[model samples]
Every structure is written in structure tokens, then in C-alpha cells.
Target: MQSVALLLIGIQLVYAGKHSLQYFYTATSGLPNLPQFVSVGIVDGQPFTYYDSKIRRMTPRQDWMAKSVGEDYWERNTQASIGSEQAFINNINVVKDRFNQTGGVHTYQEMYGCEWDDETEEINGFDEDGFDGGDFTTLDYKEKRYISPVPQGLATAEKWNRDGSLQQRKNYLGTICVEWLKKYLEYGKSSLQKKVSPQVSVLQKDPSSPVTCHATGFYPSGVTITWMKNGREHHEDVEVGELLPNEDGTFQKTSSITVTPDEWKKNEYSCVVEHQGKSVTEDEIRSNKGDSVPIGIIVGALGAVVLLIIIVVAGYKVYQKKKGFKPVNGSDDGSNSSAHTVPQA
Candidate 1:
């Protein structure tokens, strides 16, 4: 299981030779202070466009995206997102009816994407739907069919299969999607392909608390953090966290291990981070107090740095505004669709 976990992380993070384009759509019911519908476009793991029911507009999230397109593009995508908003709103209720629920917080989500391997020139596509955090249906691009894990999704699968949607999906994923992905890569090559190394630190709260190894501000979002004991891989009492995005499009992650102070005094323990063909280690944290900083102080310093970055970004945006820069926007086309039918009672 550990090896499998590492392999999956590698696949998600090691994108030096591969690229992907993905879009996520989400709708909810009975939730307050949140948009009823939201759509996001990501190219190679970085968000480039976004829309929400509250804003009712499609907006670019990156500078390249804004500069590469015109106002017409934003208008078209906004219209498309408005249509998707209604469809997804209806979809949430339809899914709720399938589950035999009348009210409460419920969610419906769709994720679709294509992957390109530069070295092999291989292309792959995926589409999936979920309800209340569980898999509802998925598209088998290879078989050109839909698979439903629960009975509730059978009707949707059947309808999609009979409606000539499979061929449409196949063609889009195989050709149109790939074409757009390539265009995006070319347009944003400098920002998308650049690499940034992480700043690693070992932190401890107190004598009895677990030790945490943190890596932040790394690009490409692919990193592995492991604990080593006596020069061997250590796994006991270890907790690995999910990858989280930073404000500047980089990523951060933490992995912690629990060990007694006595054990630390006796054995050699180190934190190893592997990213982008480079390895970083803080082997002296266990034995040297000078190297292992207190968690509270480190967090405070990080908070200050984050505030500084935010200020700098705000000033830069103001500068762009003074220079008469504007935001830009995507149309849904058939590429973005619900592609699901509600099950009948």
C-alpha cells in the first residue's frame, strides 16, 4: 500500500514529460453563502479560468489567459456558463430525487479532462460524475461507454449510450481536447513550464508533540515527503497531508511523524523531500535543536511572508489597471456538458 501510494503521488506530480487539461463543474442545494453553481478550468494543474453563479461572469485567472483572448471570448464563455448553471441546478435536484431525499445539503459534481504524454505522444481522456462525494458514473473512453457504480446511474448510462453521445465524446476527447491543450501550452509556455524548488523546514511544537516536515512554494504540485530512521525509510506513526495550493500558484504539503524525545536522542531521523529529480534532506533536526525550529514561530513567520506577497500582488494588479489591462475568458461547447440522465423511480 505504501509503494502504491508513492506511485500514485508520482503520477500526479511528475508532469515534466506530460500535460493535462481539466475542467470541474459543481452545483449544490440548500447551502447558504455559497454559489449555487461553479465552473473552473485548469491547464496542467493551474487554474486559468473560473465562473460562479454569484458573479455570473467568466473570468481569467492568469495573465496569459487574459492577454491571449478577447472580450468576445469572455462573453461566449459567460453565456455558456449561465446555461451550465441552470442545467447543474436542475441536476442537483434530479440527483436528490434519485436518492429519495427532499431537502438538506447535497452536491453534484462533474470532472472531465484529457492527458498528453509528450515522450510517447499518447493521449488519454477521462470523465466522471459524483453525487454527495461518491462516484455516480464514469466514462470509459477506451470502450466508448459509460459505467455506473450504483443502480441510480443506470438510466443515465443507458440514455447516454443510446443518444450517440459516446462517439461525440470520443471525438472531442481524442482530437478537439488535445488541440486546445496544445494551444494552451504554447500560449503559456513560460509560466506553465517553469520550475521552482521548495523551501523545506522541520518543525516541532513541544517536547511531546509530533515533528512535522513542511515544503512550501513549490511549482508543479508534485513532491514526496518521507521520514527516514537510521538511513532506512520509516513509516510508523506518519501522517501525510494533501497537496494544497498557495496564492501564487505554487503548492505546499506537510508530513509528520510521532516519536518520543528519548527515541530521537538514540536514533538518527531525517526528513527527505524528492521533487523534480532533486532530493533535499534535513538530517540534523533530530539531534540539533538549532535546526528544529518551534512550530509556532515558523507559522508566524510564514504568515508575515504571505501577507507581504499579498501586498505585492495587490500593488501589481493596481499597476496593471493603470496600464489599462483587462480580463479575458471559454465557451462550453459540447466539451462541457452534464452528459447524464436522471434515474426514474
Candidate 2:
């Protein structure tokens, strides 16, 4: 029984892979730079930057099958042993047909195929993939069935299932549309791609001096601030504070750190502002307690010192060998310096 289940999963994965479903999976899974929903507005009369929610929240659909089946029905069948399987399968088919009719593919699978019995792969109900996973089943039921990694929040779950089908759908669709438009303005893609930005801010810092750092102009509501000391990340030193909203409907955030002057000189200090799983922007300024020389000068100085020491040691050894001195033999007078003697003595 389990073997067939594994086989089906393998086959679906292959189908997903052969047709490049992995890309869709990854695109949906939060790959940077690909594209995702974001927010946009004028902050202090200036343009706001992009934002991505790594895991988009789930919402109920306008035509959610669970709702159509009735809340009472859903709650009852949701926990039933064999009935749950039937209900789940039925929802899968409904979602499949809906997406097909709309000329779109929701989630990763082309069509969700549910099992009627453990042994035989049979047809059942289904739901749309792009919508919130919450709309479909109870939190425990979802964990047991969908195998989705999205965290289940009590706040979302409490009201999501109880709401009317149309209400849930409107709420779900509206928020997603708003997010989608925001992304359209920012990334110009429907889904967010996972990729790192090429631009890196160079920071100034003294190896031995301690300095304070802060950031302004962010949607303070959903952002976090952290410090990267000398390229090494230090999460412990982070101080997150309230996000001060701007007059134009945007937000601003600030983060700070204090370290000794010596640490700053040897290591770089970077202020990383993070939202979701990606770094929005990292502003860095550099200072040095030792000598404010170009990196090239530091490298050159170290190299010169090493070379000089090697040359001096090499010259002394060469001079001794040239004079035919015996290193281990003592002079006849027993002086400290070793002496050379002819083979005949």
C-alpha cells in the first residue's frame, strides 16, 4: 500500500520535473529575484522599495469546495476515517477543473489526483493551489494531507474556516490582488523569484573603534534590522524597534550596534535590513582605527616584511656555506664559534 503511494508521488514528481514543475515549485517556494508580490507608495515624497513575503498567507477562494459542501459537512467529514479521503479527493477535482476553465495552473501539480482507497488511485475532490491552504481543511487535517510547510497560525485558522464562502473568497482574492499589483509595480512578475541582488554597499569601520549604526526609510511594520560584523553575521547584537510610519502611507525602521574600535578596524560593519527571507538593502560605511590605507597598501606592507625576513635568513645561510664552516665542530681553543679542519687534522 505504501509502495503504491510512494510510486504515485514519484510519478507525479517526475511529471512535475520533466515539464519543469520544479521551477514553478521554486518560484512558488520563494526564490529571490524571480518576482513576488510587494508594496509600493511614496514615502516622504520619494518612492518606496520592494517587499516580499517569503510565505504568502493563505486565503479562502470565491468558489471554495469546502464551503460549498457546507461547514457542518466539512467539519464532520474532515475527521472521518474513510470519508476524509473521499472529501479530499472531491475537492482536488473541483480545483483542477476550475483552474483549467480559467486557463491557468494553480500550485505545482497539473492536476491533483486523490486516492479513493489506499490501494487504488481513484478520483476525488480537490482545491485550487494558488489560494490559501487554510481554506481547505482543518489545521490538523491539512498537516495530515497536503504536506505543505506553511505555518498554521491560530489567528488565521479560527476565522478562515468559519467564514462564508464568498466572504472568504473576497478577502483572499482582494489581499492577493493588492499584493500582486504591488509586485507588478516592483518586480514586474506574478511570482517572486529567489535570487541575490548584485549590488553590495561598502562600509567603513575602524578595527578597534565601536560605532553606532541605524537605518531609516522602510515599511517599519514588517522589517527587521541586524548587523554583520566583518562579514560575520551576529544575530545576537540586533536591536529591533517599532516601525515609524510615514505621512505618505509607508514606513521607516532603524537598527544599531556598538563594538570596540579594534574589532571595527579588522572587520567590516554592515547594516542589513531584512523582510521575508531576502535582504532588501544593506548600507555599510567603513572606518579604521589603525591606518586608513587602501587595501592594496596593507597587502603590500605585509608582503614586504615577509620577503625581507626570508631574504636575510637565506643570505646568512649562503655566506656560512660558502666559507666551508663546520657547524657542529668546536675550535681547538674551545671557543664558541665552530671551526673547519682539514681531513688530515
Candidate 3:
């Protein structure tokens, strides 16, 4: 019985260890870092670009410097095509559809290169030290802005500049970013994706019930958490909720917006959680916390019964030994001789 008990305990510990290991791996590897980039237009309505600022840091001399050193030039000369919004949307939908048709994974790599603006070109002459004005002392154009191709597995959105050059959209730096985005998109489809995928929860409440957003993520501590009503970033009229740690060591947060009972009745309320780097959501989950003490009590009761049985059995064995135990007598007869002998004559 003792052996059996030990075996059972060993088995339970093994099972628990296996479960813990599995959960640890899942929490660590199952999700991808959310790709952060702005969508150009609607997925099915326009051809837009997603420029990854994270990638831009790679060639800081060109990509990073160009933006800051030539901010005005890049902004001014950067052409905006409003008419192509719908066209861009349509193209992206085609790509999405093609991805669906493939039935497995999708791989797409896009490369974009564009010439720096005139003003930026002129500034190339100035080094960390100010240079005196002279043609001989003028700067050299050592760098050309090139966006790396997003490898084979990730879906990306980007824009083409007016001169047929690549513009900033989703910046695909290389393998790491590409792999990260692939995992990210995969999670997005399954409603598990974070990193830019907005955490959305649908609550059936008064149609006028205001919904608020709360956030905390890989983003800096000071990031802003805001509310949105019907998709507008809310400013003045909502309440924010507390931030908590996620099961995966990331962060989970909540916020609420108030409207009216009427809004809630319509079931149109949703909680949108946005942290700096990623966001997750919780909606009307259709369930609440569960009770556990009943099972615990039952287990405790059974353990007590076993312990009592062990104690009672041990006591009975000791009692039986004491009842049958006798001291050796010198005479063969069990009765004492004093009882029968005539005063020891």
C-alpha cells in the first residue's frame, strides 16, 4: 500500500511536470511579435504600403539619417496619390485572395528603392563637423535608400512612389522581421495574434454604451491608452482600466467606456485594448469564475479516513500482542504452585 501510494504520487508529479513544460513552451513560442506598421488603405480597397520603422534602423546612415536630416524634403517631395486608394485596396484584396487559394503558407518578398530628394542630397556634404562652403568640400552621396525584401512567408502592404520607386509602407528588413510578421499574421487570423492586431471584444450592451480602451505592452511605460467610439480614437469621455500581467509574461489590460443602458441593450459595445507594441481583448465571455473548494473538501475527507484507518490498525496490533503476551513460569503448569502446594511443604 505504501509502495502504491508512492507510485501514485510519482505519476502525478510526472504528469504535472509534463503539463508545466508544455504550457511553458506554448506561452513562449506560440505567438509572434506583432508587426507594427500603418495600413495604407482598406485591405480590399487600395494598394498601400506598410513601412517598418524597426527595419529602418538597420542602415541608420541612410534610412534613419535620411528621415531626420531630410524630413522636410522627404515629406514635401513624397507624392500622395488619393485617387489610387480604391485601386490599392482592390489589389491588396487580390493578394489576400491568392493567399487564401494557396491553402497553406504564403510567401511574399517586396523590394523598393527610391532616390533621395534634392535637399537631402545637398546635405550629404555636411559631416559631423560643419564644412566650409566649396565644391571640393561638398559632401558625397554614399548612401541610397533601399528597403530589404520581406522574405517568402509574410504578407506585407507598401506603396509605390510617383517615379515608380518604392515608398515607405511595411519595411521588410530581412529574415527576422519577415519571420516575425509571418507568425504575427498567422495569429491575427486565428484571433490570437497581437503585435499590432487590435484586441477587440464584442459586448452586447446598450447601443449607446460607451466603450473605452486600456493598454500595456512591449511599449514604453508612458504610452497612452485611449478609447474609441465606433472606431474613433477617444479623448475626453471614457474611462480606462487597470493593467495586468499576461500568462505569457506580456501584459494584459482593460478599460471601459460608458454610454447608456440603451447602448448596452443593442450589444454593440466592445472593449478595445491597445498597448504600445501589442494589444489583446476580452469580450462577453459567457462564463464566470468557477468554484473549487468542493473538490478540495472531498479530497481532504478521504485523506483523513485513510489516516484514521492506519492509526486504528496499528493500535489493534499493539493491543492483540499485549493481550496474548505472558511471562514464563518455572512450573510446567500454567497456574502458580503457591496456589496448590501446602505452604511450600
Candidate 4:
């Protein structure tokens, strides 16, 4: 049983290679006049700045965002896709063709994916919109009847189960994903120039409240945020959040620790932000601190500065080396679909 499950995930990671994939496919067009549903995709969970399903056209993020696809061309492609929605849905037959006994009704479904996190050496998590909407049944390598509720959460799981042609299509999707990223990197190279040294702020809910460290508007999501006291790293009462998208194409994360007023006043609590190979200790950003660098200062003679882009590939080799998973990369918890829309079994 485990072998079969492992084999399945193996196929997906093989296609994904190194980059993490965030894809969405939707075809919910009930009315006659509304624009056809747009299938959006993201390379690393950011907006699908380049590709749209209507034309299957991929371009640099700048071109796509600037209407380079053109108003006339976009409308023509959109209308064509809207007309083909039924056929597209038929190819997959996501409706009556159930994957498991899980049950529920979901008209408008979504697909969410988080392929690999190289920094953490983990395969993040998977979300297949409204696939089988229910709980699960377990079977060991011994006698699990079938993967009833399809494990669309694994990113590659859905496409692997499809026909050979479809599977190939998915594989190519991953390949093209890398190309799209490379284009964006070249087009928006300067977006990487602004280095806003993290400004760490601590907020307590109330007098007797817990403390939260907020670091926002920083580029290249490699910043390691941790709570420290008296020069020691503390994880115990620290609830670190995943890096989330900020409006300005930067990233934000929060780590909090519970402390009483006494500890808060002791001035021993500080948040540490490690970015671009330098470490800065933020002592609640009180008056004792000033701007690291005005951020506007020119660095013509400052020599080379390395900035990491927000993409996920560092997992391909490790994923291959470790088989499907390792104890450290999280468990094979099963191709379980926590879909809230899986119909009642």
C-alpha cells in the first residue's frame, strides 16, 4: 500500500523537477454574459503574473501585466476558452467521476498547490479545490481497494491519473514554468534592487498580551525570523507563521511569544532578522536605533550584492535522492484529500 502511494508521488516530483508549482484550473460559467472564468496559475504561490488559460500563452510578467497580450487578442482567446470550457471539463470529467466515497456538493471549486520548499527541504502542502469533499479511509500497502478520493493535493497526483497525453501536458507545464520564471527575472531585474532592511515591530494585544514580531516589505523571502532573549534562540512559545505575500511583491512573516508585562519591560526581548547574509538584532525598534541605510542611497561602488528570487526548485535533487520522502520532509500522511466538497459517500 505504502509502496503504491510512494510510487504515485514519485511521478509528480519527477515532473515538477526543482521548481515549486502553484496552479489553478476553473470552469465555472453559469451566466451567459459574464466573462469566462479565468484559470490562474502561480509559480511560487505569487499571482500567475504571466500565463492565463484562455490562450495557453505564457509571457514575461511585464508583458502580461502591461496588456502585451493585447485587448483584442485577449478577448478572442477568452471567448474561445469560454466556449471550450465544457470540453475541457469533459476531458477530466471532474464531476460525476468521483475519486472516493467522500461526499459533498461544490459548484465552484479551486485548486491550490505548494510543490517544494528547498530551504526547508519539504514538499510544502497540496490543495485540490473541491475534489472529493470528505474525510478519508486508510489502507496499508496490503489491501487498500483504490485511491477513491483522488489525491489532487499532491500537485502531480491529478495529472498522473489522467491519460498519457494529459500526463505529458502536465509534465510540459512544469517545464514551461521554469521558462516563465527566467523571463520575469530578466524583465524585472531592478525590482530586486530595493533592499528595505527589515523593520521589526513588536505588538502586544493588551497589557497582559502576547508579543508578535512583524517584518514586512522585504524582498527575497529567505529572511530567517526568530525570537531571542538575552542572546539565545527560543522556539517554545514562539509561533512562527509561513511567509505570506505582501502587496508590493515583497514578503511578510510574523513570530510571536507570550510574555507578561514584567518580561516585556525587561527589554530582554528582541526579534532577530537575518537577510542577505547579514544579521540584525531589533530591540523592538526603540529610539536607540536609526535607519540602517536610507534604502535610497546609491551603491555604485558597493560591489556585488546577491539577491535570491522567490522560486522553488531546490527540492528536485533531494526529492529524487530520498525516494518520495524522508522523515524530515514530513510524512506520507497518504494522498488524503481534505476537500470540503467531496460528496457524501
* Full ranking by TM-score: 1, 4, 2, 3
Tell me how candidate 4 scores on lDDT: 0.37
Candidate 4 lDDT over 1-345, as tens digits, reads 121121112112122123444433333334334322334334433343322334454333333334323454344434443433444344234443444322333223333333433344444333333322231221111121112234433333333344352333233333333343444334344553344555555565566556666766665544556666655666777787756556566667777677666665564555655555333332324222223211111112221122223332222211111111000011122121111111111
Poorest stretch of ten by lDDT in candidate 4: 322-331
RMSD each, Å? 10.6, 32.4, 37.7, 12.8
Question: Between candidates 2 and 3, which one is better according to lDDT?
Answer: 2
Q: Which prediction has more favorable lDDT, 3 or 4?
A: 4
Candidate 1 error regions (>4 Å)? 1-15, 277-345
What's the lDDT for all of these models? 0.62, 0.26, 0.21, 0.37
Measured by TM-score, how close is model 1 to the native structure? 0.78
Most TM-score-accurate candidate: 1
Question: Best candidate, lDDT-wise?
Answer: 1
Please, what are the lDDT tens digits per residue for candidate 2 over residues 1-345? 111111111111111001110000101122244322211111111222211123222112122221323344323222221222233234334444433433332222111111121133221212122222222222232322222223332323444345443233333222322232232223321112222221122223544323333333332123434566545567665455444434443334455455555554576655544433233321222223234422211112221101110000001111101110011112222222111110100
Off by over 4 Å in 3: 1-225, 263-345
| Total colliding residue pairs, candidate 2 | 50
Backbone clashes for every candidate come to 0, 50, 42, 17
